[model samples]
Target: MSARIGVVTFPGSLDDRDAARAVRLAGGEPVALWHADDDLGGVDAVVLPGGFSYGDYLRCGAIARFSPVMTEVVDAARGGMPVLGICNGFQILCEAHLLPGALIRNDHQRFVCRDQQLRVVNDATAWTTDLTAGQVITIPLKNGEGGFVADEETLDRLEGEGQVVFRYEGLNPNGSLRDIAGVTNERGNVVGLMPHPEHAVEPGFGPDRAGAPRSGTDGLGLFTSAVRSLVSA
Candidate 1:
């Protein structure tokens, strides 16, 4: 059976449909989950897509963290359910304490939108199993407060534990510490990244590579990896 992947839609979410489409393209069934509902609809995995939830009020993802649906997502994630957060959703994961560190304003103090190159630093995570360590992939990244910051100790711990999943390959758009673009929980079940993988899952819509045509569909691996993880489990 196709894996059922839940894509949560908050009031201000902009990429919920894109995430669902990505899941469907990856050969999984997409289940639309609502922020007001406390149920996950028995999905095998969940994706918190990129968007300015709650208008990014107070702080990025600060208000959305307490939404009723997040309670269930937290519980399910703790039970080893695969959770992937992208861009604004990454902020939500950090706010929910599912992931460590916080996203701050870009060091350049400007909203950045570009085709970012990222290296797969750790392939053990549920969302990155199909990638090999050191492999570079291009994906769309668009955010204002996308810089990742944490205490020195926390950064060390993440590095020491091999939890840093993806790192910026070329120019760091947000000035994230250590050029970190993504990280995963210790169990490797939960992953969060500042890039929008859902937007890079399709051919014409994805980023363009240097020596190739606009064939950058590397983001498809993320969703397919989740399906593989669920099937293997």
Candidate 2:
């Protein structure tokens, strides 16, 4: 059977449908999960897509972290289930303590939106197995609070342990420390990033590339990597 990936939709979510479509395009069954629902429907993997959950009240993802569904997600994540968080979802992951560090407002105090280049720093994680180390890919990035911050020790530990999964390639867009763009938990099952990879999975709707109109599809590897990981397991 094909891998079944669940995409959770919290109130104010703007990318659940896009995430589901990306899962479908990646040959996985897309299961719709709700924030208030405690059940995960036995999905092989889960994706928390980008958006302003709870309208970013009291900080981004602060309210969504307490949703009923998050309890199950937290348990499953600790048990080694693959979980990927994007943009606001990344904030949620940190708030729930599933991942370390935090995302604060951009240093420039402005929302950023553009095509971003990232280098895959670690490809052994559930969400990046399809890529190779040092491989660079372009995807869309849009966020107000995208800056990743952590203490010196945590940052050093992440680098030393190879938990820093992705890094900004050319220019750091949000003043993230060490140009960090994404990270994975120690188990590598839970990963979070501030970019919107789901938006770049489809060719015609993705960012434009050199000499190829709307040909950027680097983000597809993330979904496909999860499917491969589930299938192989």
Candidate 3:
């Protein structure tokens, strides 16, 4: 049987459909979950797609953190439900205390959109099981407040515990502290990142494949990784 993955659609969410499509393309069932609904509907996994939830008012993901669905998501994640948060979703995860640290305004104080190169620093997470540690991949990254900020002690803990899952390979677009682009919970079931993997799942639709060798569709591995982990789990 195929794994059922839930994608939450909060107000002003722009990538919900794309995330759902990626899940379907990866041979998993995509279940649309509303922000108002508390039930996850028995989804095997969950994805919080990137977007300006609640119009990004009063800080990105701040208001959305109180959504009814988030209560369920938080509980499920703590119970090892395998939650993946992308961009704005990552912000929500932090605000909800599911993930450590917080996302602040970009260093440049401007919105950035580009094909970002990242390294899989930790492959132990459920959402990154298909990748090998140190494997490099390119994916779509667009955001305004992508800077990850935490104290030195927290940073040390994250690094020591191997919670830093993805690191910026080349340019740190948002000037995130320690070049950290993604992180996972201690159990590796909940992950939050600033990049958008759903946008790069398709061959032609993703980043160009001609210029670089074996780089296009780098985002497909993320979805496939989650599906594979869910099945095996």
Off by over 4 Å in 2: 211-214
TM-score of 3: 0.97
Error of 3 at 128 (Å): 0.7
Give the residue spans of candidate 1 off by over 4 A.
210-214
lDDT by residue (127-154, candidate 3, tens digit) is: 8888899998889999999999999999
> What TM-scores do the predictions have?
0.97, 0.98, 0.97
lDDT of all predictions, in order shown? Answer: 0.94, 0.94, 0.93
- lDDT tens digits by residue: candidate 1, 1-233: 88999999998999999999999998999999999988888899999999999999999999999999999999999999999999989999999999999999999999999999999999988999888999999999999999999999999999999999999997999999999999999999999999988888877778877675538788999999999878777
**lDDT against true structure, model 3:** 0.93
* Displacement of the residue 221 alpha carbon in candidate 3, Å: 1.1
Worst 10 residues of 2 by lDDT: 207-216
Model 2, range 78-193, lDDT digits (tens) per residue?
A: 99999999999999999999999999999999999999999999999999989999898899999999999999999999999999999999999999999999999999999999
